[model samples]
Target: MLIGVPKEIKTHEYRVGMTPASVREAVHHGHEVLVETGAGAGIGAHDDAYRAAGARIARDAAEVFANAEMIVKVKEPQANERAMLREGQILFTYLHLAPDPDQTRDLLKAGVVAIAYETVTAPDGSLPLLAPMSQVAGRMSVQAAAHCLEKEQGGMGILPGGVPGVKPARFCIIGGGVVGENAAAMAIGLGADVVIIEKSVPRMQQLHRIFGHAVNTVYSTRLTIEEEVLAADVVICGVLIPGAAAPKLISRDMVRRMKPGSVIVDVAIDQGGCAETSMPTTHAEPTYVVDDVVHYCVANMPGAVARTSTYALNNATLPHILAIADKGWRQALAEDEHLLHGLNVAYGHITHEAVARSLNMPWTDPHTFVRD
Candidate 1:
């Protein structure tokens, strides 16, 4: 199998699909790797490093895309990249298709076999490939909120961890999953008052057992969310519905009512955000003001820490990549039920139910394409 690694083209996205170590592993398995020149520059791995790892460096993305059987990328293909996709070519990356109709339409028209990392599942029903980036994003959300709280950043000039005599800033996280848990950990470490609003009873109990008195766990309700948002100095929306678009739990009216200078870090922005005011921002301009409240909705928060994020992502995705490379994608997905869940589009059809339903499109089961 010949695999291609293209430099991520998304604005502010610096992570690469494969690392030098990943290329070496693939080469050892008798697979050839063609990486675009400078693809690993963001992670401090240069062309020489890839060459040393037995990957041939292509002069441009066009050559790599034209020759490789499978294209491994960190983000979804941009317009130009999508145009270069040929029928039956395998694309393994984070599509986030539920909210992006343009990308989904392009992908369907391209007839490429798209496997989304964000939708890939593990035996325990956890998203393995998406977990590392989620962890990074969760941890970064607090850091971003703290920055947004500075008076220079148009915030209330409040310190996350106040002085000995002053009260600490309050952080309200809107989910108790991996993102919410990691956010709570970081907020607590900063000595902030933390509260997590969750719908799952077992998960809330789990959070309580983990944090004890360090954090507050509340059952999610319309009233509870409103109260939390109004009282919070910073609200971190970490809600997720897997392959579907994130539910809008925080309304525009809610944003208007929040205290002036409050900040919202919508970590679920990739799935279209949990707040009505949330729109995809970039690392270049990460926040905007809405009714005197700050909203940080960077779609690729992990990209801000490219080195750590790249290594973490490669650690989780390498095994799956190897599986797809060693056994053809059809065989690989047929053998692993969890991996099959990653299939979003194939032969011009939407294969993921959640993504299709979210977009009001028809879905075809992934099993229809798997051969015995």
Candidate 2:
């Protein structure tokens, strides 16, 4: 198998699909890797490093896309990259197709076998591939909110961890999953008053056990969300519905009623945000005022810490990449039911049910394409 690693093209996105170490492993497995020149620059791994790892460096993305059987990327293909995709070519990356009709349409039109890292599952029903980045994003959300709280950044000028006599900022996290948990950890570490709103009884109990008196766990309800939003100095929207678009738990009216100078870090922005006013922002301009509240909705928060993000993501994704490379995607997916869940589109059909339903497209079971 010949695999291609292309430099991520998304604005402010710096992570690469494969690291030098990943290329070495693939090469050891008798797979040839073609990496775009400077693809690993963000992670401090240069062309020489890839060459030393047995990967041939391509002069441009066009050459990598044209020659490799499988294209490994950190982010979804941009318009030009999508145009270069050929039928039957495998695209393994984060394709937030549920909210992006243009991307879904392009993938279908290209007829490529699209495997989304975010939708890939583990044996325990956890999103293994998505976890690392979620962890990074969750931690970063607090950091971003703290910065956004500065008066110059349109915030309330309150400190996350207040001075001797002042009260610390209040943080409301909308989900108790990996993102929410990590955010809570960071916020609690900063001595901020934290509240996590969760729907799952078991998960809420687990959060209580983990945080104890450090944080509050509330049962998720419309009234609760509204109340929390109004009182919070910073609201971190970490809600997720797997491959589907994130539910809008915070409405525009809710945003308007929130205290002035409050900040919202919508960590779920990648799956579409949990807030009605949330729109994708870039690190270049990561925030905007919405009814006197600030929103930090960068779609690729992990990209800001490219080196750590790349290594963490590669750790989770390398085994799956090797599996598909060694066995072929069809055979590998057929053998591993969890891997099959990662299939979003193949042969012009939507293979993931949640993504299909979100896009109002017909869903085809992934099994239909993995059969021997």
Candidate 3:
């Protein structure tokens, strides 16, 4: 099988799909890998590195796309890249299709086997492919929230870890999943008052056990979320419902109740957002003010730290890529139930029920696409 790795073209996106190590793995498996020139440069990976790993370097994305059977990417395919897609091509990437009708339509029309990273579950019901980036984004959320809390950034001029005479900032994390846990851990480490809102009792107990007296855990309800949001100096929205759009736990009206200059870093912005005011921002211009509240909603937050993100993401996605390359998409999906969950669209059909319901499109059972 021939695999293509294209440079990410999304605005301020600097992460590529694969690394030199990943290329070497494919090459070792007797698969041909074509990498776009400078595809890994943003992630500190050079052409010579890929060449050393036995990967052919293509001058442009067109050549890689034109020659490869499977295209591996970090983000969703941009408009131009989508136009270049061939029917029945395999697109393995983070396709957050629930919030974007246009992207959903384009993927369906292209007739590509669209496998979403966020939907690829593990045996334990954890999102394996999405975890690496989520870990990066979750940690970065605290960093971004701290920066946005400075006065120059139009924040309250409070320090996250205050001086001897002053109190540290308060952090409210929505959700108790990976992102929230990481953010809360960081915030607690910085001596900030951290509260995590969780819906699951077992998860909340786990969080309590993990943090003990270092942080507070709240059972997420409308009243509790509102109270926490109003009191928090830094609000990190990390709630996610897997492939579906993240629930809006913080409303516009709730924003009004927040302290002036409070910062919101919505880690779930990729799956829409948990905060109502969040729209996609870029790394170049990562923040916008809403009712004097700072919002850091860069859709690709992990991309800001491209090198770490690239290696981490590749580590998680490489095995799945190999599976699809070794076995055809149909065979791979038929063999692995978890991999089948990753298939959002295939051959002009909506194979993922969540995406179909989100876009109000007709759904075809994914099993229909698997032929014995």
Cα RMSD (angstroms) for every candidate in the order listed: 0.6, 0.6, 0.9
**Between candidates 2 and 3, the TM-score winner:** 2
Candidate 1 vs 3: which has more lDDT: 1
Mind giving the per-residue lDDT tens digits that candidate 1 earns over 1-372?
999999998898899999999999999999999999999999899999999999999999999999999999998899999999989999999999999999999999989999999999998889999999999999999999999999999899999999899999999999999999999999999999999999999999999999999999999999999999999999999988889999999999999999999999999999999999999999989999999999999999999999999999999999999999999999999999999999999989999999999999999989999966
* Whole-model lDDT values for every prediction: 0.96, 0.96, 0.91
Per-residue accuracy of model 2 over 150-234 as CA lDDT, tens digit each:
9999999999989899999999999999999999999999989999999999999899899898999999999999999899999
User: Which pairs of residues clash in candidate 2, taking residues 3 or more apart in a chain or in different chains?
Assistant: none
TM-score of 2: 0.99
Off by over 4 Å in 2: none
lDDT, model 3, position 15:
95
TM-score of 3: 0.98
TM-score of each: 0.99, 0.99, 0.98
- Candidate 3 C-alpha lDDT tens digits along 103-201: 988988899989999998999999999888888898999999989999999899998989899999999999899998889888887889899999999
